[model samples]
Target: MNWDDLRVFLSVGRLESLSAAARALRIDPATVGRRIARLEEETGTALFAKSPQGYALTEAGQRLMAHAAKGEAAFLAGAAEVAGQGGPGLSGQVRIGAPDGVANFLLPQVCASILDENPELELQIVALPRLFNLSRREADMVVTVSAPTAGRLLVQKISDYHLHLAATEGYLAQHPPIRALEDLGGHRMVGYIPDMIFDKELDYLEETGVSRVQLGSNSVSVQFHWVAGGAGLGILHDFSLPHHPGLRRVLPETIRLKRSFYLVRHEDDARLDRLNRLAALLSERLRAEITRQEGLS
Candidate 1:
């Protein structure tokens, strides 16, 4: 019935945890729980179901999802318009999500630069190996491997980065030999676990012509480091692998794969000067970083 209650509900629904919502809202868990209950009472239906895994939206809650989003968009649009009228530069929390590899390797530098410029802003990085839902407010901004063909959001290709089959020099030394592409099949390889890949963009292993995996993980950095530690061979990003001296590209001329980065932001955020500025900054830095990696490699 109240806008404040709807705001709290949106936060709770997005986070699915009372404690998390409280922390994000700068309030107490009991308050968040009470407000959610009050909202349910006002609506005359249960909003969320509690389970060991945390709260999940009920059927009633699902129906309110779009309306809640509309409320959020209205609020954000108003905030952005007010912000543009004049204040300190972008001064609100901005959450950016990306796969673990990009999160670990790329976003730190980008975030630092942003913070340096917009000192008053709060930046949160959701560095996980999952697909973020922009519509669900899972992240205000996201760096994904592929662009969405259908979404009410702004899409931009960050860059086309290259990956190559590689193994630790130590592993190469101790292993039998790798003269050609076929030799990869004889060696122990590290890569992503097929089923756990949350996005189709991460299904890189099937392209490598190696069916079996000696060691693997859902995190790209983990598999990369495993290869770096001489655990096995892996397909690594050119943009990230230059930092590790132990790894050597295998069949540098032959076994390279290319993947593109896509940046997606919600439609509500499109008009926000801060978010748009951030998107531009990210695109620039990403391209520059990829260039730096190119020279380093």
Candidate 2:
């Protein structure tokens, strides 16, 4: 079996979808399907079960993955060792998946520094609404608010952030006062739709008997935009609040909630020289951004 085929199989197995694996590998979906088909032919057993939701690994596929993962690690380590003997002008692309908030507010400075230092390196930043699959290599690195549970992934807590309830002064003036958490019910509150991590935060408010929220778009930017436009009150990250002059924190201390941001990468990618350097640079830059924000506040 070709090592390339194995790589494709591993990606598909982790993501459970040919299309997603294809996108991660920067290849076409047809190529992903063909590689998996060839692998199955060589093994003389079905590796996956096709379903409407996505592809799932079969019993044999699961067993094959153990060996594939080991091989992949060995290959990457050897490659890195060889590459390390060369000069520092490493040339390659690093794909990063991050939340919209980070993409908009935090990553520009990081990007600038990465480009400044590694002029030969190319960086692709994919701003996603949710976490991308690092194990599948959908992203070389990920910045997320939710903690990842995948065993094959390496996660680092980059920073801690707080969220606060916010509203336009105009909106607050026209509507009832929001002195207490319960008083939030009297006003139209813009919030994330159900079944997202943001919803979990909103649910926390609901469980506290603060259930007066109107479902808004899932995008945090969208929710905050509405609040800025005087649509309604919504919870926003503390870092995001300073950018909008009209919006003010309604209950800065009492209604604050804290969450952590993580920088996650696949364990298999740890040995990639280019990836490691980029990850280090990103982590350092993000920490600096957090410190800067704290100083400004």
Best candidate, lDDT: 1
Candidate 2 lDDT by residue in tens digits, 1-297 = 899999999999999999999988999999999999999999999999999999999999989987898788778767757766225765567788988878877787778777887787788888877758665567789898866675788788888877778888899889887777778768887776656754243343553355545756767778778988999888777777777878888877688788778898878777666677777778889878867764454
User: Tens digits of per-residue lDDT for model 1 on 1-297?
Assistant: 988888888888888888888998999899888999999999999999998888889999977876888777777768777766234466688899999888887788878887898788888999889888786688889999988888678899999898888887788889888887687878888888877888776777687678888797999879878888888888888877777977788888878788899889987676567778778888888778887886787
RMSD for each model, in Å, please?
2.7, 3.2
Ten residues in a row with the worst lDDT in model 1?
A: 82-91
Please, what is the TM-score per model? 0.87, 0.83
lDDT of each: 0.83, 0.79
Clash-forming residue pairs, model 2: none
What TM-score, to 2 decimals, does candidate 1 have? 0.87
Clashes of each: 0, 0
